[model samples]
Target: MACVLEAPLRMSVLSEVTASSRHYVDRLFDLDPQKVLQGVIDMKNAVIGNNKQKANLIVLGAVPRLLYLLQQETSSTELRTECAVVLGSLAMGTENNVKSLLDCHIIPALLQGLLSPDLKFIEACLRCLRTIFISPVTPEDLLYTDGTVISHLMALLSRSPYTQEYICQIFSHCCKGPDHQTILFNHGAVQNIAHLLVSTSYKVRMQALKCFSVLAFENPQVSMTLVNVSVDGELLPQIFVKMLQRDKPIEMQLTSAKCLILTTLPCLVRMCSKDRLLEERVEGAETLAYLIETDVELQRMASITDHLIVMLADYFKYPSSVSAITDIKRLDHDLKHAHELRQAAFKLYASLGANDEDIRKKPILESGAIELLCSLTQSENLALRVNGIWALMNMAFQAEQKIKSDILRGLSTEQLFQLLSDSDVNVLMKTLGLLRNLLSTRPHIDHIMSTHGKQIMQAVTLILEGEHNIEVKEQTLCILANIADGTTAKELIMTNDDILQKIKYYMSHSNAKLQLAAMFCISNLIWNEEEGKKPSLLMHRQVTILIKKLLLNSNICSAQCIGIQSVMGNIILGVVWIVGVVRRHEEDAESSLGETQGHSDNKQELERHRGGFHL
Candidate 1:
């Protein structure tokens, strides 16, 4: 115990034991059979629990001695097992230990032991080989160049389920580098890994999945081969989907998801090149989209590929037709497939443009995504409409003015307005959001106001009055705020007393965003008002009270609220004459008994003035 506690003492003891063990091991073959077995047993026991001790033994020349025993024709199975166990322990130690084993040429002996009839010998040999394979100091060129090591591992994969997991782990370690991945695939390792996916042992299956995932990652040829290989008429894609089931272990699901992403890379490259058949291209796009659906990094990677955006854009335009299928069930299946393709395309488009304006321009707008999305909004399928509107919404957010105009021209104004009445809450919500984004462009706002102001106003009012979704109402308020930017539009909105009332009501609502949006609309409505033209009646006592409450409410204070307060201050300053008129009325009332009633009547008159402001 003291030796374990003190590093120098431990090293001294290990050095003495290793030196004596080396002397015994050197004369092991010359000794009697029982003595040779005892010497090897003693060597194995010396390093069983201590990696530093094992490393010391390797430094003292135990590796070559152990390799000699493994290579001996007359060595007993017990002697060979002990030799393999010692070698495995040595290989599992420091980098110097692995380097010593490789320098002593022990890999061939370990490979030989893998073919032994004894399961324990084979397992020990595999453990050592796996350790060497994973060691950073191990020469990758040496292990993969001869092809013999990979072949032996593939052989062990078929030997027994007990050994298969270890062999799979070895393959996983070897498949780390691109050069090694090519070697493994060239030796049919990818196919073997695919076969092991159906292994009854979950451990084997997981290791195999990991091996394939490592092989598939960034190795285009390996990815292509895995996807092209078919077993029982099912490709690797189908098997990966099956492994991604909800009931499977999370590790398996995660591995399968990653592998699926890698497997689709080659297909995507080919699709981008336009070198594949239409069916193949569509299949690849669908698979890639499914694997990277909600994953941001993979989506970014997929978006940057050469022809991927163009290919997906074309698919968006001409979804696979389901009419060719004659059977009703097949027809249903094909229809669902078509719908999935459209959904995948739009989802990918949304992800691609979420952060990149170049993607929005090149892949989305220039690729005719706007036209396709416009057409999709008229589809009978609710999912397609919802996805199309959502994609359009993202496209319009913070977009260039010219791009916004192009999108507006591409979309059918009537069709878009009709979607505002959509039964699906999601569809309506997305449509309202899209409208809000479109209104961000000043030109688009002017066009909508001049051509379709009444319809647009009606749509917003209907949603505000009838819709229940808070998000939709918030978007509606944003649209009203934008529309009120123009004088004619402001007058149109202000004449509608109900719209004004709703805006005033929302100003005091519990939701801070709604309150802000309504305040913004009110601020824009009263912006730069003339003294005589001011909506004195509309700025009723209750309206002013609400604004004062908002100003004093600590919880409601935000950056946007502060901006609104500045605007409210400007509105008050602009209507200084109105304050003077109220003051004069107070003075007139102070001189008479009827002044109190007059003050009350004038307050009611101011309330009526609030209704007339064209907000």
Candidate 2:
């Protein structure tokens, strides 16, 4: 009886434990919606607390569930926001997690959240969108369909500085395609971005500039739109220039520089249209000139625009007048405008002539640019004169023979001669460079020598004897060399005692460049002549010293080796010519003496024959 009672109690205890275990299993797998959301929140918190939890959550299907919660219309804002945040966090997680988020098609829902009024929700959505857009695997067309997503984001640009910054960044990514750039522009992105350029927030302004940069980069239509907007408002261009100023942050300045090249430059090129205001055209040309000076690509791009040449010529034809200014401020402003206009015009002219000889001739000369440049070279304003001569120099550098002839004929010999006496050293240097280019060609050499040869020689002599910059001295020496290239010019240079003394003086100077230039000048004087007819360059003591110095210097390593070698070779040839001349002179003297003695002997023989006939 005792054993039977113990067995029944054990069975009851086993049944009660089985019922409790089944109830606990049901509770663990509860399907309650609130319970499911709470569980998700806990997982999100865990993922946030420990980034390592993201991989675990991804493995457990958290991405799809969060995306589903975002798709639910009745989902609370908090829940939807949390879902977006969690999705964004996961997107920011591992590469696999991003792949998981993308696979769930979360972009549309996040874009919907962009329409939400709550800034945090919008920010979370933007973060998610930004990450998705930045991924290489994300299809470009994913966010773009009928332009709705881009339109919505552009609408959000006016919300807050933070929102504007994020929206601009998103647009920057979207603008990777021409179609996307067109869509963005169609939806007032250009106007919006132009306004954002003046935003009080530096971050917003930076992002806005970057958006403009991306949109305008290689997109001519968008660049034109931004430029038009800038012209109508006159604010955007100023903002661009302001950002480029030294006072702005370096980052802002750098971004501004890029915008100036990729956007402002193209816009300025287009703005060269004839109907544009004179002030607007001048500003555009000035900006282009400033940019092309620092970048070769810009120079090439700017040169191709045929209208820019026309517009610049038009401005040169009728430049802004400061003559009527009575007020001091107006006078100052007019003076500044005149200076900038002249500088920009000349620089653009130089850039256009950099490679193409046709550009140097057809458009420039047709537009009367040569006449304006010639006139400006004589301007009382030093800046005008400097830039004018500089433009002429670029025009003449490596120019075709025809182009050089055109330049010489366009600028009178007297004007060019007067430029040689300009008080400004820069003016003098550029004038010499132009003269060198002109004198390099055979046709222009006669005009230069006949008209201004004496004055040029005198000016060069003065500059050489005076205390001037080494560069100026070197350029003067080059001009002298070019002058000596022609037979007439060479004779004139050789006969001038003062110029010869100057050349000899520079040959012995401590500055190696001056010495080299002098050697070059001397070598040209005696090059390609008959044996005994070459000028006696070897007669000067400085020439001997220079030869020895060059021989010694050639043995040493130097950056100037090739140039030095060429000069040394020319000098050696000159020396050999001199030696040949000396030998030819000696042989001629011996032949003459032989003839004289033979003639004397013949005369005595004739006289003896006559006396024998008489006997």
Candidate 3:
């Protein structure tokens, strides 16, 4: 060998990686891991060398060693930061094995590092928390106790813009869990969010708003707290007004709109009583109503209306005992500024009968609202048609008996015959629904069934037999339950040859949605009782088959499982109820023949029980 010479050039601590340096790292990894670890230490010293090299070393079973280096008081500040970065990456990665942090007081030391004079150290701590938060499970207690994370974060942000930006990102990720969210809210997180609205950095504001949106999702009370803060005049309006004045980002605008829709609607209704809301109220009311009307591209309007109508009807039906609305005059008050709502309701009804221009030309044709709705079998949109039928249903229930009669007039034998043969299954299904209601009342049912009994029965048979749409089948099933009140219907359906096969076909249908609907129909059909025998022998057999099928499907949720149990339980109860009813009927018949017998209280109890079933 030539004269032995030591390598004269050692890598400087601040040297950054170049193409040759990267090649050197590659060779070190391939040739020897001892050399790679040496390289990692050198890179950590060299602010100039590969930061990636230090992080990569941790992935390969070196994270615990790196973290140990970070904890040593003698370690260089730069080296400690590099080690933390590597550890952070390891904790975030799928292959991390450094669980020994539990034994070492690493969390307290990391919190100390977060306050380091070196910016790199603070950045590294933020990154560490970020990585830890991404894990499926988070260790909250350690971070909360040592970091005192939220309080320290607020204090740091009050001092500097750059610090605020970094803290917002960390807080956004940390406050994702509901427990953390409650902690944040309890410790002035809402005010912190509001403070960031005017943040100098775009990223900081965005992150802060994102955090606020998540917190507000199931916690409208947070939004209420935000609104209650004394930042602006009359918080709700001020928020929207300020939103329009500023060049708001689209995401912020969307978030504001969603939060406002949820929190503000109820607030606005409450505010309606105040003189301030009434003064110059029409313009504001129209604007808000238009926004609600257009929200979700019109899908939510019908749902909203459904809720309001049901509330109104329930209140009308049972005032104090079952009041759906506590304030009787709210609708009247809303009507003052909500001319649009009144017009919209009329327009909604109009659409049921309208072709194209006929809609705009007339307030929906109420003269034959029911008949025209029945005829919308030709409409292509099934949802619209179904809704039309539902609207007619609500209209029929209007307190005015005239409205109900006008609906019934069109459901005569001739009209029903045409409806029964319509190609659109929903038309026939809805028609049957109307007929069921008409027949449920005194005099009319027996009258209609006697004249159009055979045809109406045939129509009912067709829907039960031939309808394929699950929704149509469900409606048809409910209609059958309504009409299946007497011996005539019972005999007709049981005797019909096609009926059993159709029921069997529905029971065997492969589609889950269809199966559920069919099951519900079958459940309702046999839910009632005949005398003391309980469920008829025929009904018991069908229910047993259903129970067997339901038990086999373990994928079902507890709610659906409970529903199945309820139906089965009711079926069993129905049998017992029927037995009791038969015994009571026999007892009454026997008592009528007795010379002297009176049990007025027993008769009254039976009457009350019978009253429970009438509606």
Give the alpha-carbon lDDT of every model: 0.70, 0.67, 0.48
- Name the runs in model 1 displaced over 4 angstroms: 1-38, 64-84, 93-126, 135-142, 145-166, 177-182, 195-206, 216-292, 297-366, 375-385, 395-428, 435-470, 476-506, 509-513, 516-549, 552-615
For residues 199-275, what per-residue lDDT tens digits would candidate 3 score against the true structure? 66777666666666666554545655655654433454355445443488787677666655544543432232224
TM-score of 1: 0.57
- Look at candidate 1 and tell me the lDDT of residue 285: 61
Choose the strongest candidate by TM-score. Answer: 1
Ranking by TM-score: 1, 2, 3
Candidate 2 lDDT for residue 588: 82
lDDT tens digits, residues 357-447, model 2? 6666676767777778887777788878888888888888767666666666767767766777677888888888887877775446756
How many Å off is the CA of 314 in candidate 2?
2.2
Give per-residue lDDT, candidate 3, residue 9: 13
lDDT of 1 by residue, 1-615 (tens): 010113453356464564565565565655687788888888778777787567555555566667878878788988888888778877776666676677677777788777678888888888778788888887656565565767777767777886888888877776667677777778788777777788889999899899888887766667778878876778988889999999999999999998887877666656634345445555666566565556655665566555567777666534335564467875665455666567766766666666556667765677778888888878888888888888888888777767776766777668867788888989998888877777764556676577767878888888888847788888888889888776556666767777877887787787877876886776566542443344432345444444444455554454645644544544443244344444455567455344434455544454444422222
Model 1: ten consecutive residues of lowest lDDT: 1-10
Clashing pairs in 2: none
Q: TM-score, each model?
A: 0.57, 0.56, 0.43
Q: What is the overall TM-score of model 3 with all chains considered together? A: 0.43
